[model samples]
Target chain A: MQMEATIAQSVSEKVKTSGAEAVIRSLLAEKVDLLFGYPGGAIMPVYDALFHYQQALKHVLTRHEQGAIHAAQGYARATGKVGVVMATSGPGATNLITGIADAMIDSTPLVCITGQVGSHLLGTDAFQETDIISISMPCTKWNFQVTKAEEIPAALAKAFYIAQSGRPGPVLIDITKDAQFGEVEFEYSPCQNVRSYKPEPPINPEAIEQAAELINSAKRPFVLFGQGVILGQAEEEFKSFIEKTGIPAASTLLGLSALPTDHPLNVGMLGMHGNYGPNKLTNECDVLIAIGMRFDDRVTGDLSRYAVQAKVIHLDIDPSEINKNVKVQVPVLGNCKETLKHLTQAVKRKSHQAWLEQFRAYDQIEHEQVIEPELKPLGPELTMGEVIRQVNELARGEAILVTDVGQHQMVACRYTHFKQTKSNITSGGLGTMGFCLPAALGAKLGTPDREVVAVIGDGGFQMTLQELGTIFQTKAAVKIIILNNSFLGMVRQWQQLFFDKRYSSTEMVNPDFVKIAEGYGIKGRSIKQRSQLKEAVAEMLDHKESYLLEVHVGKEDNVFPMVPTGASVSDVRLS
Target chain B: MCKDFTITVFTEDHIGLLNRITSVFTRRHLNIESLNTSESQIPGIHRFTIVLNTTEEIVQKIVLQLEKQVEVIKAVYHLDEETVFQEITLFKVSVEQAAQHNLVERLIRDKNARILSVEQDFMIIEKTGHKAENDDLLEFLRPFGLIDYVKSGRVSLIKPDEELKNLHELVNEAKQANNNQSFN
Candidate 1:
């Protein structure tokens, strides 16, 4: 670490007196080595200060503010460090909100610094000004407005600490123009405490003991792992516990990479649109030890009827998550790693051979027979399952998969087997669209050496298509596949199930993706028929720079055998 | 981890404050082993306390939560055992006819306590503040005979730090700047 000498303790040290300089100084003290952002008038102060610190920090200019925030998320998710992004006030700030909420829901540690209109004009409905603090409150771990330049240091430092500390989440610090321009002696030290925030720790000893007792007592013991295990770095410990107890494990989409997909005990995914055996096992298991995974509607249809036969033991890091959705008979709150360690010590091996045999038999039967009648003529020349299988083959057990929200995400969930948790990134809780393009850019940037593929639907890719410019600008080689069916796949599937197939505004008009990619000065290809799928995917694979591979699939298709909402687990509708 | 804490709060439990209060107890890494909340008849007021263990930062965070609660009028957190004040409970005893007369005036003069009820069997006395003070008075009043007593839990407060750099100076500067900008 450079011993920065006699750093400006007060405003006088700035070669330029502005809040922007203080922001730079604060960031420097916080040892912020990199920043992701887009420039604008409202954020000029930040840029001005940033110029002086070029030697100390690196900056990546995203094509849009939204891209910048997702890049930050990618940075955070990959490194488990606090991701930071900067943007101009108004639309710039608003643009970053979805990404901010995305990080919030996923509990990634992200710090977003946005420019704000000056204090005098705050509440007057000033042009290009949004009440970012109020707007981001529910979506942030905490939100603040630094109306004064002097508070900038503390606020930013506090933002980083809170973001990286206990049960990390996104935090926003809105700096007003005056504060950005104003100068003060900048002192950067983390705030030891913030009044309004309190993150719960892992469950206490008694609770852990009771949880272990339940696990030990069950004849058909199984674990439903979620992203929390990844966040807690409990993969090794989790494997250890399961090895000792011989529990069959299934992962939520976010927990895909936690266990190697090929493990015998690994049931690929459970719930609607998942592997039949796993979903059945999930329903029939006597005890469902759900770790870190919330009972998202997609994962657990009909909360009342979800795993009705089983006694669920819920373990999560957040107290609000314990009973907020699915009611669990045993609620254990704590870090997933810590809680798993306690369980490993407290539990003993028990046999569930009869239970295991039943599931295995079902697995063989389901694997041999068609789970659902193979997608017929209208169901597209290629099923999502086939695409994932080919993609995984091309992936060579390496490249991280980034997905946007929709049926494709489900297809990816049931289809791909991950080697580690967090290897699969998606908008889990906040299922935001237009999420993949930028998030892939961020992920590729975070891991430039590794190949990264963004598996996206037509509806989502359009939301952030502007990012092709960012890819061209940065020359980030991220391979993206537009699962183009000319409709919002998930909503269409919903309509097919719930709304009488009255597809309202779900169909998307045609766009020449190749031309769009060309407009951004990148390579693009279009696949119109089944014979073209491999060729398009091959072209994307060998492309030297970012490529947009548009695969035209059928529009009438649905991710079938889906357990419709409000339907019991045992009542899944498989045609 | 084994965490322990001793805290006392002075406040009014406004609607929804109890949840806000306990929410902190649950949210922060504290395991509330025991919690007590009861009426303080000083109009819309109540006293609540929690015992738990956690880091100093978490405890201060809880204090900040208490201060932020809309219903909590005031909050005090004390850690030291000896240097805080607590309410003194009262005890009454049967007095022999001869000892009763002297005891009444003696208790009143020494402890500044008042006798609320008097009967051949016993007199009810009330004393407030330090436990030691109440004990001294109870001894004199016990001439009748020892009865029963209740001492409220120890409520403690560490003296607030003397103001160093004015924390509100920034607010004042912002105010002045606002005024100047408005004038322009």
Candidate 2:
């Protein structure tokens, strides 16, 4: 790590008087190591001043603003720091939207800056002009349009800070061309008064005590962990609490990587694609303790029917998220780790043999019943469900897996064993179609130390298939497994159930994925035989650059044991 | 089919842009409506409009989605005849229509529509005004009527009063508060 102690000063001395320069300098002051960007007319001033911090900032030039954003997401995920991306006005600003929305949905930390046509041309529809601030309103955690040049430094500084704090998500800074071009004497001072956002920091004593008391009181309590645990780095305390109380625990997609997959107390995922023990227990248990996880609809099918048998104790850093969805019997509004620590001292573990026996028996029966293979044909004859199990077995708890939207995603959620938060990245609320590939890039960027695998369906892979070039350019150590069923698999599956297999436009036939992967300068392979999967995965993971392994599975395959839309957990059908 | 026939209002410094125009279109409840409002250039010019969907539901939904932005001030699919209206449209007619086109060319000549271009198929015409102008013009040019036309919806300005001024101030105040909250 080459230290840039003087680079910050060099930037401050040179660009301090200029608005765009001040913005660039503030970013450097915040110790931003990388930025992804595409430059144009309105944003030229920012790019020009960006020259000074070249030593400190590693700027990745992406072909499109969307690519810039996704790459930034990759950078953020890899470094566990806030990602940064910049773009010029109009289309450039709009292009960054999908990526920003993705981060919002998955709760990733990102800072996006877009240039607006000068303040004078604000709503004129001037060539290349867009109302960037208003357009990005709902998609971002916060957004601004800096009309005055003097606002740039503070705006950039605040954008960076807000993006990194409190249930982190994307923030946007839209500076007019005038702002970027204006000159201003800049004095760098730490931003101290953010009046609008007062995040209740992770430090509530009494709530922690009550949470601990509830945890110790219930022998069958289970922790439904999510991404906040990973964001807060609360896994250690999470592990400690589980060990102390001997409580069974499961995780949401975002919370997958927070704990070790091999940990004995680890139950599994609980949701539409949830596994036997976790899913069953979620609806069966008396004490359901959810930590650092929002009760997303995907995770809790038919909210009215979810955890009906359970008394909920919800712990999260975000107060908005606490009672937004699932009502909490015990609300611990603090960081998971801090809250858990307080509980360890405030409460004692209990020995309830009857409750433990009840959970164990249910787990045993369901595991046996659910894991039995239901067959379909395409060589290896592996259903989407089978792939999740195999991936789980082979991973044996070390790989960081990501998935695209559809049945395969759900099956992976149900069958794959996840142990940590922020480990799994998928479009949860957004349910974005072409999320896996780019997001896998983000995930690999987030955790370069871990083996990153993205499980995508044939349809999802095709949506943003243009990103193969990005993966190759970065040489990201990502192994993408394409579950080629030749259909918009999930939609097709739904039609199969709801519309009498009308199929409509759901069916699709894809080109050779391996060939397509190879076309982009990455290693590629296709596996149709069951025996080929394990070795192919091993070889693909070993590749220096990104690799694509396409597995041709059955098109008729649908994620089974499904509780259709508006259906309760008891309405689950296994066919 | 829930297609919307919109009326865009661009008015002079009026005391009641909304009251007069809206009451006209809405009073009869002639049709369900959708409306939108925003400030346009030529300072103090406010854009007020209505969307009446008697056509495709999807387009209506798409327009409704577009109306969701906060800066849009007001956007809804609740339209009726009692709504006030003003609109500008640019249409293209065939050069062939010049020789013997009926009441259409006559109207085109009256509105002083500039013929943008004329090809083997037809010609391009540009016009601006009230809905009757467009309708009477459309009836006249019905023979060699259109290639394509884009109309800006109604835009109405409120009389500069305590209320509208306060709204502008409130908007700035909200923006300031949001900006302050975000930086922290």
In order, candidate lDDTs are 0.73, 0.69
Candidate 1 regions off by >4 Å?
Answer: A1-18, A29-31, A191-203, A368-380, B1-184
How many clashes in each structure?
23, 55
- Expressed as tens digits, the lDDT of each residue in A1-575 for candidate 2 is 23465555634553446778777777777777678888999899988988866777767666668777876775676467988899999999999999888888777789898888988987788999877666676677767678787777777777776687767789898888898888876756545434334444557677777777667667567778887778887778888877778777777776776777667676666666565556555777778888888888767778898887777888877765655667778888776767778877776765445655665675666555555554223344767766666666676656777788897788776666665545566677678777778767766755678888889999988877887877778777788888888888889888888999898998886788888888888888998777786777777766777888888777787676566677665455555
lDDT of 1 by residue, A1-575 (tens): 23244243432343444678778776776667777999887899789778766766667898889888988887677656678899998999999998998997788989899999988898899888988876776567766778887777777777776787667889888988888878765555655544323354546888888888888889887788888888888889888888878888888777788888887678667767766666766778888999888778878877877777888888887655665566678888888788888888999976566776776786666555443333223454666656666677777757788899898888776667677556787888888888888888888877788778898998898888888888888898989888888899889888887899999999999688889999999888877676676666777887878988877776776775567777766666555
lDDT of 2 at A53: 65
lDDT of 2 by residue, B1-184 (tens): 4444554443322333344344333433545344566654434445655665555343343343332221222233334343345566667666555556553456555765556666786666666666567666666666664556666655433443564456456434433544332232
TM-score of chain B in each prediction: 0.47, 0.48
The candidate that wins on lDDT is 1
Please name the candidate that would achieve the greatest TM-score relative to the true structure.
1
Against the native complex, each candidate's DockQ, computed on alpha carbons, is 0.03, 0.05
Model 1 TM-score (B-chain only): 0.47
Candidate 2 structure lDDT = 0.69
